[model samples]
Target: MGRGIVKVWYDPEGDFLEVLFEKKEGYFRETSDDRVMEKVDMQGHVIGFSVLGTRNLAKMPLEVALS
Candidate 1:
């Protein structure tokens, strides 16, 4: 598979962080945690992820897995 561009967007004002693996047609969905969410394409491949609280990340356990 061809590799896609990766992009990271952080909204300081909103305290949100988004890491995009591929910029394509996709939608965001909430993961198990309320502070985390992921984006998936039509084929069900994860394209990106978002975190609600970025500043407090250091205080909590952080692990990213989509399975």
Candidate 2:
């Protein structure tokens, strides 16, 4: 089997950054924090995550759970 590849998509216009663990079809669900979202597949596996307002948030220290 081959190793998994992570894909990152950043939109400067929207100031959004998405880090995809798997390049598959999935939808984003809001997490406990409004600035983050978790992407899951049909089976609800955390395939990736997203960060909103990156430019603004970069000024301060931030942390999030990814699992």
Candidate 3:
């Protein structure tokens, strides 16, 4: 058994980002979503991950976020 997951990867040529949504274990099932990728810089201490909004995506820094 495995955990459910979503993955984000860089797309340099398209100038956009790729998102992969997957249901873990059992069947090999996965799909992708197209998103405009950008970088996010955190203040204070960078903690665990949180859900992001459209506005948050817009505010991120392209250089760092792509990683």
Which numbered prediction scores highest in TM-score against the true structure? 1
Candidate 3 worst ten-residue window by lDDT: 24-33
Score every model by TM-score.
0.85, 0.82, 0.27
Best of the candidates, lDDT: 1
Considering only N, C-alpha and C atoms within 3 Å, which residue pairs clash in candidate 3?
A: 39-61, 39-65
In model 3, state the lDDT of residue 30. Answer: 19
Q: Cα RMSD to native, each candidate?
A: 2.3, 2.2, 13.0
Computed on alpha carbons, the lDDT of every model, listed in order, comes to 0.85, 0.84, 0.34
lDDT of 3 by residue, 8-47 (tens): 6554554544444432222212112223322223432221
TM-score of 3: 0.27
lDDT of 1 at 17: 93
Give the candidates in order of lDDT, highest first.
Answer: 1, 2, 3
**2 Cα displacement, candidate 3 (Å):** 4.1
Compose the digit string of candidate 1's lDDT tens values, residues 20-61.
Answer: 888789888878888888999988889889999889988986
- Among residues 3 or more apart in sequence or in different chains, the pairs in candidate 1 whose N, CA or C atoms overlap within 3 Å are none
